[model samples]
Structure formats: C-alpha cells, structure tokens
Target chain A: MKAFQSVAVIGLGSMGLGMARSLMRGGHEVRGCDLARDALEKLAAAGGSAFNTPAAAAHDADVVVVVVVNAAQTRAVLFGPDGAAEAMKPGSVIISSATMSPVEAQEFAARAGEHGVLYLDAPISGGSARADAGELTVMASGSPEAFSAAQPALDAMAQTVYSLGEDVGVGSSFKIVNQLLAGVHIAAACEAITFAKRLGLDISKVFEVISKSAGNSWMFENRIPHVLEGDYAPHSAVAIFTKDLGIVSELGRKQSFPLPVASAALQLFLMTEAAGMGQDDDSSVARLLAQIAGLELPGMERSN
Target chain B: MKAFQSVAVIGLGSMGLGMARSLMRGGHEVRGCDLARDALEKLAAAGGSAFNTPAAAAHDADVVVVVVVNAAQTRAVLFGPDGAAEAMKPGSVIISSATMSPVEAQEFAARAGEHGVLYLDAPISGGSARADAGELTVMASGSPEAFSAAQPALDAMAQTVYSLGEDVGVGSSFKIVNQLLAGVHIAAACEAITFAKRLGLDISKVFEVISKSAGNSWMFENRIPHVLEGDYAPHSAVAIFTKDLGIVSELGRKQSFPLPVASAALQLFLMTEAAGMGQDDDSSVARLLAQIAGLELPGMERSN
Candidate 1:
C-alpha cells in the first residue's frame, strides 16, 4: 500500500479547515483552497500551502478531498469550468466528503473514473473538535485501490472508518440516511426542550434528567445545552440541515419513498430558516417552535 | 414521614403489572386492581393481592397508585361509581401515573382534594423492562405532602424522579413534552432506516455504521434492531404514540399552540395505526414507510 504524500483539501470552512490541519499533522504536504482569501491566507500562515483554484491544488496531489456544502458545490469543486478533475493526474483519488445525493455520488464516481482517477464516497461526521483531534467518523466506500490510496489520510483524520462496501454510491447512501436521522433528531430535540420550557419546566432540569433517560438522543444531549445557554452560535447551522435534508427529501422523493417524519423535520428546519434563524446553531430551531407556540424562548425572552 | 406499609395499584397491564412486582420487591403489601381478571390473576401469582375493584384495593391502602391507560381510565379508577377515592381514608395519597393532559391532571388534583386526598401528578417513562427492573423514570409534581406520601412507592418503582414543582399539572406537562420528542424520534428513525433499505443499501451495515454516527438516537439504536431481526413483539406498541401524540395535539389545540412537528408525527403514527400495525411494536412504523414506498424491508424477507 503506497502512502499518500500530498493532499489537497478544497473548502476551508470549519470542517475543512480542521481536516486540513489533521492532514498536515499526519505529515502530508497539504494544500488548502477556498474562495475566501483570508481563509486561504490563514491556512498558509499555519504552514500549509494556499491555492486560489481547486485545480491548482489538485493538479499533482495524490488525494483531493472536496468538503463543500452540497451536491452542486461538490460538482463544481470536481468538474466546474476549472474543476479539479480536469487537472488531476491519472490514478489520483478524489475523496468526496460532502453530504450529497447517492445518485449524484454515483455520477461523480463515474465521471472521476472516466478521467482515469479513483473516487471514494466519504462523508464525515463529528464536529470540528473531533476533526481537529483526528477522531472523526468517516462513512467510506470505493474500489479497493481507492481505499488503499486514501487509508493514510483516513487514518489521520478519523477514529472510526466504516468500510461500507466496494460500491462508490453506498457510502453516500448510508451517509444520507444518517443525515436524515441526524437532522430530524436535532429538530426533534429542539422541539422537546423548547416545548418543555413552554410548559414551565426548568430547561436545565429537563436536560439533566432526559439526558439520562430513553427520551434522549445524541443530538438532544449535545444540542440542548446550546438552547439552555441561549447560545445560537452555529456549531452546526440550520442552513446545513436545509441542504442535507433537502438532499434527503429529494432522494426519498425520487425513490417514491414516503419519509413523512423526515419531511416534517425538513419543514421545521425550513421554518427556522424562513424565520431568519438560519445562521444560528440548529438548536435555534427551538426558538422557531417557541415563536409558533406564542411562548417566548429563554434566549429570545428579551426580544419582546 | 410515615412509611407506606400497604399500597394499592390500579391497572394490571404491562406497566402496572411490573409496578406491582416492584412494589412487592420493595416490601410493600400491594393489592392490585384491574378490569381484566387474568391480569389481576397474574399479579396475584406474582406475590401481590388481587382485587376486582379499585375500592376493594384502596379499602386498607396507605397509598394508591393509578397506572391506568389515560385520563378517562384514571378518573374512572379514582372517582367512578365505586372509586378508590370514595373508599380510601382521608389524607391517603394518590399517584396518577397515566400519560395525561395538564388540564386533566389539574382537574384530577382538584377532584382528589375534594375527597380530602392528595394527588401527585406522576407520569412514568422507561417502558416495561425498566418497570420490571424497578428503574423507571417518574416526572412528578404535586403538593409537598403528596410527594412525601408517595415517596415509598415512588422510590420502589423509579430510578429517577423529576420533581417538577408545586403545580399539579407540571409533571404531566413534562411527560407530554418528552412524549413529543420520543414519538417523533422513533418515527424519524423508522423513516431513515426504511429509506436506506429502499435504496438497496445493506441494512445491517447501515445500522452498524449509522448507530455510531451523529444520526444515532435512542430510538434508532434501540428499535432498528427489531426491524433488522423482523421481530416486532411489542416492546412499545404503535398505538402508544398515536395516543400520546394525540394528547400533545389536543393540548396544543387547546393552548392555541401550533405544533407543526408534533402534529406531523401524530399523523405518521396514526397512519401506522391505520395500516393495521396498531398492535405491533412501535418499530413497525418502519414497515409502514417501506409499504408506502412499495419497497421490501430487508429483514422482513423471512416472512415473505
């Protein structure tokens, strides 16, 4: 198994930035790219290379990881007018780490294969903290060669790497399924906490107890504190779920699947976005619920 | 505080049956009452006394715990033609353990107060297994004297007791909020897993991977296995959520609160019930999603 020596991370947002740092810590020659010059300059200041275009970073790199927002951004990063696929060397691997449709992943892989490059459908989970700690969980699938090629970077960036199957689209399939639950759980948790608060129960007490009960979820325990602290800062923003659940609903509809619960969750997230809380942490969905109920949320208490 | 030496339990279904056993284990002399003769027989065999009427059970009881199905049943047990409240001595405490609306709870307390009895609005969670293990969670609120009076049985039956406040309805309110999340989460999990299976992703692998991911929830991790094993032996039944979420919607309607997410979840559970899985485990909601999509759930292959 040949080790990856140079990798390009295209997208210098919170997740992308932490991933680039992990790659650099793994002793790879890391090139980071983003439209934001300040983000690129920050990466360069941290001793990584900065490139204006994804193609410049992917031109001679052994691995190019695209961590942009959704399928369109993923497609643009890989095959846009000056996309990375057109400049990548033969046998170089493209590890798409964004949340995208499984069908889109299948198409992306086929396009990469046509350009004589490998493709691994790898969508990451865990926040920036775990990403920076090199302990994220990666749901990954690809051809054996792509897996072998991506192993070093995968090992450096994740604590748990689920080797789903040799099929490129399956990883994305699993990841989208995951996002459906994750997105819904966050919205549901927000609803639970805010509803409790509306009922005049202590928010901290509800958290203290439910976190230990079966009513709890990973998202519930993790996100309720943000609601309690009245901190709407985007650990994971409502806009993210808007994109991810959009992918989920679109794919579910394509398959003629009735995902009423997930669809309802998508609607709540949409309401949150429409109410102008889209930039806030997904927990801010609680505020939207409170608004619709005519009950003032703790954080939004002063607004009235 | 005087220790409760003799207690009477109303209702002998799964939850009540388990509670009777836990009370016996806690060294209380318990008399169990329910309309079902067989359930009462089982309780008698399990070391508790059995009575045909609540009045008979409460005749010599120090504490009376009503674990019936709903507000109606609870009212019937407490104040019907031959109710426990009519038979019990003044100052005997009643722990109402049914999932009920806040209005019903307050009315129940007022009615109990008229009988010179104390009422603790206590709605239990953690399911039958926890009930059997004497490790249930009780969301309880009442007058301090009522809490003190119910402490012995509460200690016996619950691992966690959330003291909501002096309000008679606060505990029921919290339980309703918890139910809103629990029902939505379980349904969302079903939707995601069935959606994944419809896409032809490996069901076991999807469960294995997603359970460790952010997508994981208390319901997903616990109930998806029932879907995987094709076992829907009613740990929690589909009809349960329909009833609970109905309470939520009814409360919302009365309060003029627009509960979009909770209402949507209520509809899905109602659909699951309408699809003839009403008696099946709550996880059977997963099968409903697959049925609507015209896709075969992987684990149900055996039944086919």
Candidate 2:
C-alpha cells in the first residue's frame, strides 16, 4: 500500500510549480504557497490547494518542500514571520531544494533539528521540464530517518535521488561543484561563439563543427543555439549564473580554494549582469562579448 | 579518378605518421621524414619511403604536409636550411598543419606565395587515434587553388574539412577559438572534480552524476576517468593546452578581445605545468587542485 502523505510546497515558480504538480500526480495531497495569487490560482486549477503563506500551507503537512531561490529565501520561508517551520508538525520532513553552500545547509539542518523536524538537504537539477515529468535529479544528503521520511516525496519529484552521504551538508557541496562546472562551460561557450564571430567564421557553422568536436560541452550544445538565433529570451537567465556562480565564488572564498576558472566565469556572469542583460538568456554572455568587441552576432546587427 | 599525388609528410610524429599511412591507403605515394628514426622506420615498414630530412622527402612531391609542433618548427621545416619549400616544385601545394596565430599563418602564406607555392592554413584535431583512423577534423583556409591542390590529402586524412574562409589566416583564427573552449573546459572539469573531492562526496559518483548533468563537457567526460583511475599518462598532455591557450591568449591580445574565462583556464594549465606535471595528461590539473586542497582523489589515498 502506498502511504500518500500531505505535502506543502513553498515557492510556486517554474521548478517549484512543476514539482508541486508532480507530487499531486504521485497521489500526495499538495498544499502550495507563493506570493503570487495567479500562481496559487494555477495550482488550484491543477487540483492542488493553495495558501497565501508558507506557514499556512505547512500546517498539517507531513513533508514540506522548500524550493526557494537561495539560503536567505529558504530561511525566510522557514523562519521569518509566520514561517513554515514554526507551523510545521514536529515529525514532518523538510526537503530543502535550494542551490546553496554546504555550510548554509548544515546551519539550516541544525535549526530544523531543534524543532524535532527532519531536514533533507536536497538540491535539484534537470531543469523545469524534468520537474514537470517528475524526473528531476536530486543530490540529497540527510540522516537515515530523514531519507526514510522524505522517500515518498523524493520518489514523486525526482527521477534520481543521490543519497550523497549521511551528513546534512554533502549534497549542497556536490551541487556547488556541479554549478562551478556548469557556469564555466556556459561562459566558455559564450566566449567561443563571440570569438568565432570576431574571427569572421560563421557562428552557426562553428556551432555545428564544435558540437562534433572535442571543444563541445553540454552548455555549449544547449546554449549556443540561442546565440545562433539571436534569441535572448531567458530559458535560463544571466542572473541565474550570477546567482549560482556567486554562490560558487562565495564558497571558494570561504574554503580558500583558488577557483581561477570558475571565478573567471563568475566575473563574466557579473559583467553580463552589469550590462543590463541580467534577465536575458544565459547565452547573452556572448552578446556582451560581441558588444565589447564591436562585432555583430547573428540577427542583432544594431546590438554592436 | 583519384589523383595519386606524391605526398611528403614532414615531421612524422604520431599525427604525421598516421597521415603518411593514410595517404598510402588513398593510393598516393607517401614520403615521410622525422627526427625520430623509429617513426621513419615505422613509415618504411608501412610501405612508404622514409627520409631523414624534410627537404629530401619534399623533393619531387606534389603536396608537402607540414605536421610540425608550432610556427617556429613549421617555419624551419618549410624554409630553414635545405627546407622543404626550397626543394618542392613551384606549383606544389603546402598544407601547414600547426596550431599557430593567424598573423603567423598569414606571414607563412605570404612567404610561400612568393615561391609560387599555394599554402593552406590547416590545423588538425581529433587526436592521434583519429589521425590513425584517417578521421581527423581539419579546420582549413586558403585560396581555392590551394583547396583544389590539397583536396586529395584532405580527403585521405580528415573525415571533415571545414573550409573556414578563403583567406589563409581565418582557419588559424577558428582553430584558436575551438582551442580556447577546449582548454577552458578541461581546466573547468579539473576544478570541478577537485572541488568535489574537497566536498567529501564520492568522486566517481560525482563523475557519474555530472556526466549526465548539464555540467558535463567533452573534456569532462573524456578526461575525468583518468582522475578517477589516478592515471596521469599523457593521452593529451598539460603542455598541449598551455601551448594552445597560449596561442588563444596571444590572439585575444592581438584582437583586444577579453577572454577572462579562457585566460583563467590558461593560468590553471600553466600552474599545472609549473608543478612539474607538464608532460602528464591534461587531467593532471585535477591532481594539482587535489594537491593544493589537500584532498585525496580516488585511487590514491596517499596523494593527500
């Protein structure tokens, strides 16, 4: 028999909303909370109940899924005024799904443990589409009891849940390492494409050639199409890297690890954000490079 | 009809030796030369004629493929004392396959043109294995006459020959862009894996996850196994990226293009080289990071 528990989903953004629907699809009762009334309405239309705040949603929930942006937002959702943790049942599991530092995850886990709540450090990847399909890859670490408590919700929302270690912070560490590479690859892709344009090579042909060449990366293959078509629409925004690579930079500083490559990528993201393309597609780092070089990329001749 | 030209492969390194054998397979007469007597003997054993000097090999050959190390070696091979260009017929083609700056390529093309020799700025990729199989990727640029002259050799040695532009230097420019991304991705992969080690996650499991995640790169997938196995044998050495990214940095400086990410990668490669692993596999950058962070990567607990 499948024991379907009541789940509270905080933050009804793209990933969060998809995760909430997946939980509902898994036959769990979902109570969702977000600042946007329209997002709440969308959840209601999808047969899930919606509340105005996280605490209201956390009430009576057996597992609370926190899918906010960073450690601060997560802290706000759980411990701010009328925060969910104050209202969450003592034995409920809190699945934290923010891309944050391991130290932050550790701190949060300790705070949650004080309330007799199980905290699972679970950071998700595979993007929004995978979330919709309940196929997100979750890098998670927690106690055996926390994993046991969160297994059903993990099963519903993730295709793969990597039980990284018994410690609460290891998942965040793994996720940061993943983010470090991801940010660097995106920046490298942008640098290559823009540099190709400067060299008078056809950017599209360069893409095709490099896709088959050892120069290719997952980000290069996925993100360069946006450059080829001059699509600046944010499938994933420049600000996203600015945020994620910012966390990477922060962690590197705290750890005293010299992250020359990832830090360079982070600065480029910061530069792209400063140029006012923060909300544009992450590939807009190419646009920034093109702009700086006074070269025109495809479709946007006036951009230079 | 296949034009069976007499092809001289100068500098019969692994790549050159492979091209020599491949030319023989294409029904061309192959004359090879190298400083390494064993390499020359390998060509001789493969039914190709071998010479101790490039000039001797180039004599009476219709196409001279210069598969040398850099612009300086390529210059010496083509125009040094009793050089191949001086020995070759006026109308014969010179396919220069060195990773050089565009300026250097243009200078060589101009020099070759004075001798009535058509020069193709052709830099090869796909490594020794691909070279052995006659499936390398050649990013080439030259005049139409140069293309027409070198097409047989190109067809024999390369699975794909990208005719980047009509100008001689453009091919070098394109190759530099590709190299820039390739080097950065390698360094980024090293940074990521070492960071994963610092995080206390299973490095092999991190590899398995990131290979499927968006963080993956061609270098990451192709090179991390070396780190996992603690094998640092030079499949592609750290020195290769140092040279390549050095060219990229030079090109960026000449063009006033900011390559912060690539430059960061270049520094990491330089650091890895400085640490006395210059001849080791480029994945040795991970070993360097592991050393700095005092973390033990898989397959070597004593390394820490």
Candidate 3:
C-alpha cells in the first residue's frame, strides 16, 4: 500500500496527539490542530507543524483524520465554517475516528463524499498508551477507495484494523456494540470490587482472586488496579463511558432494542459523573459505590 | 497434609461427582450419594461406593463434603432426617461446597460445631470441567483445625485454595462477590451480542471483534461460542445464575448496598428462566434478548 505522504490530524487530544506522533514516525509530514495550545505546542515540538484550525491543517494534506470527541465535534471539524473537508483535495480521505452511532457515521461519510473526499468510518480503541505506541485497534469500514486512501495512516496508527465491510456504518456499529459491553463490564467490575469491600473481604485479595477466576473481565483486570492504588487519575475518565454508553443507549432506543445491561451501566457512569468524579478515572465508580454504602475504600477519605 | 482415609461425598451431581472422583484418585476411600441413580451408578463404576442417603455415605467417614445445589439442600444433607452430620464421627470435618450467603454459611458452621465436627466454609468455583480435572478454585475459611482436617480433600479437589480467613463466613462472602460479577458479565455479554444483532451487524463478527477487544470477559470468551454456533446446550444453565445472582441481590438488599448492574442482570436471568430456558446454556439469555427485540439469533428459531 502506498503511504500518504502528507497527513492532517485534527483534535490533538491524548489519542489524537499520540496518533499524530505515530503518523510522523511512519514517515508522513504530519500537521496537527486542537483547541488546546499546549497540545498543539507538544505536537510542534515533536517535529510536526501545528495549526490553530482544522482548515489550516488540512489545506495541503493527502489525508485528514478527524479524531474528535463525538459526532458533533466530528461534524464541526469536517463541515463547520472553514472546515477540513472544504480545505482538503478532492481525492484525499477523511478518516473519522470517533465513537458514534452507525447512522451518524453514515451521515458523516455521505457529507465527506459530497466534498469529493473518500471517508473511512474508523473508530479506534486501545487507549492513549497504545495510540502513542502506534498499536491501537481500529474498527474501520468504508469504500475500497477510502480504505486504499487511508491505508498508510491506518497502518501507522493501528496495530490491527478490522475491515468490517464496504458499508459506511459498519465500523460504528461494531464500535457501539463494543462500547455496550465495555461500559457494562466497567460497571460490573466496580460493583464487584465494592461489593467485595461491603462483604468485608480484603479488596486487594478480592482483586487477586477474581482476576484469576471466571468472574474476570478486561475492564476488571485493567481498572481494578486504580482502585487498589487509590489513584483516581483519569487514564480514561468516567465521563467517557457516560458519553459512549449514552450513544449506545440512544442508538438502542432508535432501533427499539432494549439494552437493559448497557442502560444499567450507563446509569452508574452518570451517577459517577453526578458525584463530581466525571473527570477522574472510570474506576472511581468503585469509590462512589463505597461512598453510597458508607464504606471506606483504600486511599479514599469519606466524602461526607 | 494428612489425607483423610475415609471421605463421604454427598450430592453426586456434576461438581460433586467430579470431586468424589478426584478424592478417590487422591487415594481416599470415597463414599458417594445422590438421588439420581445414573450419577450413583457412575460413581460406583469409578470404584467408589454409592449410597441412597447422605447418612449412609457419611457413616464411618472421617470427612463429609456437602456439594449440593444451595443452602437449602446443604441444610438438608447436613441436618435433615438421616443427615450426614449425625452420621459423621466427632472431630471429622464437614466441607460445604455450595455457594450461599455468608450468614447461611456461619449458621451451618455453628451447627457443625455443635455436633463436635469441624466445619470448613468452602465454596468452589471454576465449573464442573475444572472440578473433573481436579483444578477448581476454592474460596475457603475455617478454624486452624478445620483447615487441617479439610486440607487433604481440598488438595485433591482444587488447584487453588484461597484461605480467606479463619472466619467461617468469609469464603461464602468471597464466592458471592465472584458470583455477582460472573452473573452480570454473562448477562452483559448476552445484552451486547443481541444488541449487535438488533443493530444488523453480523453476530459472529461481533463475537470475533469483542473477544479481542476490551469488551471481553472470561464469561464472554467462554460462552459467546454457544451463541455463535446457536448451541445452547448447558455448559452452565440459566437457572444457575438466577439462583447465584439471587443470592447477590438478597445479600445486597440485606446490606443496603445498591447493586444496580447486578440487579439488572438478575432480571435478565429471571426472564430467561421464566421463558423456560432455565436448563439451557446461560448464553440463552442472548436468545431472550433477541426474542424481546424481534431479532433472529443464529441457531435460534423465532419463538413468535
């Protein structure tokens, strides 16, 4: 596959910045842009150009990757006044790497297509660490031409790219499905850990035992350590799941499908957000459970 | 560990039968009992004596293991007419392998103490396959002497024995916590997969993506195959989670702790059981979700 020689990465947040560095490392002339000046400066210091607007970044790019927070931000970056889609060349691809609904993804793809740009419905996973390491997993689907155009950036930014199909919405559908389970498992992990604390078992011991047992999940193994260490610093914040699972809930409602587990998990994230821990690590939900139950977790002072 | 020379295995169901064989394999003279004649005959063929009653099996045995369905059956086997506790010799140990509440386990331990018998609150996990392989994980708690008396059988039947504490109820508490997550995860797996189907994504592809993604749990990896192949034959049945998560809900209520995710999962299992899939594989909850959404899952005919 021929590598895109010039790439634009919009929304230089944790994930986007890491991906921008990865693209630069993969021999692309990368241009980065974000609302945060500090993030843009970091990208500039890493030998890539930084821009104040998506349009400035995408003006001469072979590929424009929109890695924003949600569908609205994605749309704003792509089609807002002086948007990247307007600035980019016709044959260039726009890789949309936001967790959103399939319908929203299809809408974005159609809008990009109208601008004579190829669109790849790509949603990334594996967190910021893997993103920085060029090892994220990308669930991607779009036209063959879009895939061909985005191949270099995808190869640089992802360790595995699941080519879902030619359908524009398929990648987002898979991502929403994944978010459904990830959100639920995180809630379940928090519930289990705090429930063990309520039951008077040593929370660390419970973690050790459960991680080796049938009750273990990816979230449990990954997030329980934050609880054990009493570190609520956000690797992935509680608000993220609230947003992602909210998307799942919205889509489920639109499809008339009952997503009771996802809905239940979404409530936990909402509760965590309501408790003022939205910006903390998602594992802070365990502390929220401990607080409601009137129990003290390791490293957490009683909030009341 | 001094191996108990004479052991009685009451309740020769899947888990009990496997433990009985493991004990016999460990060079113990095992006496087995079950209501099912087929289970009894299988035990007898394995060179263990099979009895029609718990007391008959416990008579002259140094250790009696009650591996029944729940606390009710555990109580029946230990204290009912012709009970094993009455038949077991003084100073012998009664190892309870059933999953129940901490309160129930404490009560059982006290009653065993009244009979001048050592009691070990040991609730086994790792399923029947692990049990048959002598590789189950046991969450155990009891007195020093009780641990000493149960060590031989514990070694024979389990790969990992988590000595939670000397407190009689500690093991059961840990087991309940494990069950809380296990049940929720299985339900979440069902919810996520069926929701994918409802969204019109390929279910098998969803399974492939999820198992490799952060959405995965031990339950998801182990049980999603049942959904993928449309084979719902019981590796573990729906009624199992109904009972296990019921214990979690009951315990949570008693503790005034809100287990919202687990509660939601419990409702799913209850619905699955109410729909007459109680004896089907636990993954059949996926079928229930598909039915509710009017979606067809692989291997499941549309019930409507």
Per TM-score, the best of the predicted structures is: 3
TM-score for chain B of each model, two decimals: 0.97, 0.96, 0.97
lDDT of 3 by residue, A1-304 (tens): 4555799999998999999999989998999889998998999999899988899999978899889999999999899987999999989999999999989888988888888999999999999999999999999999999999899888899999999999999999999888888889889999988888888889899999999999999999999999999999899999899999999999888888888888999999999999999999999899899888898987888756
**lDDT score of residue B149 within candidate 1:** 87
TM-score of 2: 0.95
Candidate 1 chain A weakest lDDT stretch, 10 residues: A295-304
Q: What is every candidate's C-alpha DockQ against the true complex, given to 2 decimals?
A: 0.74, 0.77, 0.89
Q: Estimate TM-scores for all models.
A: 0.97, 0.95, 0.98
lDDT of each: 0.87, 0.90, 0.91
Across residues A163-239, which tens digit of lDDT does each residue of candidate 2 receive? 88789888898888889999999999999899888877888888988898899999999999999998998888888
**lDDT of prediction 3:** 0.91
Clashes by residue pair, model 1: none
DockQ sort, best first: 3, 2, 1
Candidate 3 chain A has its poorest 10 consecutive residues by lDDT at: A1-10
Q: What residue pairs clash in candidate 3, if any at all?
A: none
After superposition, which runs of candidate 1 have C-alpha atoms over 4 Å from their true positions?
A2-4, A301-304, B298-304
- Error in Å for residue B236 of model 1: 1.6
